[model samples]
Target: MTSRPLSILDVRSAGPAGRALCVEETAVFQHPLLEDPPASAASAEDRRRYAILQRRAEQTCLACPLLAGCLYDAVVRHDVAGYVGGTTARERARIRTLLGITVEPENLDTLAGVIGGNRPVDHDEVVRLRAAHPDESLERLAHRLGCSLSTVKRHLRRDRNGGRTREQEPRSRPSVRAVLATARTVLDPARGSRRAA
Candidate 1:
């Protein structure tokens, strides 16, 4: 059987699906899908801006044409880091939940440079641990892992990149933004409505 093609907007339009994408999109912004940031930016505002960038990236993914392919690749490979097809670490978890798989496919090798020879944690696991231990600090965990504090914090941060705490629990259902996006499309398939707007 052939799998249905997914849209970046579709990933974000489905309440549960979109929120999951938001989590991964948040990671891509904090750590970047490309390169890691310099160690000097330990300030609070700098981190805040980095989060903003992640949310913007999710928005970008929502608008991209290849989002379906990206999501497929991410799912097949079990990617545990960065944004793909507008989905976040949390979003991927939802996918896993849907598929009923437990193993992860995203390589931890992408973290080689960021952790300075330390084996870094994957984004999905980080989300789980953060959820499991809401009182813990990502920085403290990184210290124990012998990696940069930012790297740890980046994993814990939500995909939305809003001012919310990294440890906040996710909604059991789709978010309002996601429902609106789908509803708008259903109402009028001609004109476009931004998902994260």
Candidate 2:
């Protein structure tokens, strides 16, 4: 699909105007949908307030005349998170699943282009990781990628800390039998008979 510019009006418009249906606000920024749920990381009081706002926002969105259009946009965009035109992550995931669309939000830029979402990770993070670790190790790279060492190395061709190149393969393990045999020979040398005068 072709990318299009996101308009503030598209986000802020409220209520019906003409044949296009009223602007959707509640669905676009449903307070309840935006609030961390009761089982979230917020304080108890904050959670209570969030629940209240969420309820009101849900009510407003439900009554909005542009609900259909908002739903269409939210579903088609494969938005995995946030209150897009009124749908939550759960709602969006369900819509995508029903439509046979993959629901992963790995490519945040693509999602943002379609659903007006923010990038999950940015290049600055990569630059910072590189700067902080001038001798970058695989472990550090993995942490930055939020993936396993192998996965990080696969994508990142160079180490940020300068420890090793990402393309460096694992060295083969030493032969255990060879090591044991060498150790035995070193520990037990043949003794020559000494002449007693």
Candidate 3:
């Protein structure tokens, strides 16, 4: 059976909270300000608009029942885009850095077709590619597969472990509440500067 690539909607719907506010209200949540940080030379008006949009998006996220789950997934599981869990991509990156955590970068090209790429590389495909090119490094495989090195490793590891996915294993990462608390500390200017000092 041919399986279609999972879209953001598919993933969101599969979660316990049904669908996210961002998915329903794309205009406010998926604005460029939330998806990508403003350029360094952005005008004052642009900066003002970004701040407003950020606040709006954050409010929307804060109202969602899935905020914690969404935030944890974005910060700890997938390098997703747009405003998620009341934070921008850059903010999530900062939180990950402060937490000393790194997530596998999503194959955005596969997801959006922005770079003319196709669907995600499945486990079977990864195994076939590895068998076809026994001598190729994991990095090369990742490049050819349009995925991250960690994704390649994950697939291989899952195959070796008899199909037990990461979710089935014990997690060593911090809880969502802990991550949120850390985010507040890191993003608050007063607290952040005090901690840095």
Candidate 4:
């Protein structure tokens, strides 16, 4: 599929509270895609910069409150840009295939804009898909679910071990922006100076 820019939000549905806790407000605004793309033609330093940027972008997403919502939207709409829910556009397509959700023209509409129009991937579908394809590799399963392989393993293992997937529990304390900054500095202290805006 051709890459196209998505609004990320079709509406301010999550509102201020959800928006405030978003990780995009941190490092992602610097690049069009959430992460910088590595190019073989580029210098070694350039490749390293891209890698650092991608890692920090992922770390920011991990700390966001609306991660689930962001991921769900990306998977449902076949988002064509950025690291959403830690999955790329190709991964989202795999998920859409697994969930049996056809991407109709109107699938682009936000859930807030039109209720009951899109089918988001659900936990049950994930479980069912895993069960139906028991021999499938965890990475394949994660790609199908638009999640990390570890997550696929965790959910299935947790269930088998008699534990439910944990909810997005409230995080205890600390500023997200500050934490994000610290992570970036740790990864590459001179990122700003090393790369020109």
Best by TM-score: 3
Q: TM-score each candidate.
A: 0.38, 0.38, 0.56, 0.37
Q: Report clash pairs, candidate 4.
A: none
User: Each model's C-alpha lDDT?
Assistant: 0.48, 0.41, 0.66, 0.48
Encode model 3's per-residue lDDT on 1-197: one tens digit a residue.
22112221122322455567777778877565655556667778878888788777866776576776887788888766667776677678788878877665554545566434565668899988988997666668878887765567667756877886544222568777667666665456455456557
Higher-lDDT candidate among 2 and 4?
4
Which runs of model 3 end up more than 4 angstroms from their true locations?
1-18, 111-172, 189-197
Clash count for candidate 2 is 12
Q: How close is each model in CA RMSD to the real structure?
A: 12.7, 26.0, 13.0, 14.8
The per-candidate count of clashes, in order, stands at 10, 12, 0, 0
Q: How much is the lDDT of residue 99 in candidate 4?
A: 47
Deviating ranges (above 4 Å) for candidate 1: 1-7, 10-28, 31-54, 105-140, 148-197
Q: State the RMSD for candidate 2.
A: 26.0
The sequence of per-residue lDDT tens digits that candidate 1 reaches over residues 138-181 is 55565555555555655544433553432222334444354334
lDDT of 2 by residue, 1-197 (tens): 21112221123333474332224443434343252234465568966776566555555555565544565544453333344434445555454444444422234334345323443334455545656785655456657656433333323323343534321221332232322222222222221011111
What lDDT score goes with residue 138 in model 1? 59
Pull out the clashing pairs in model 1. Answer: 15-174, 20-91, 21-87, 21-88, 22-159, 23-88, 23-159, 24-88, 24-89, 78-106
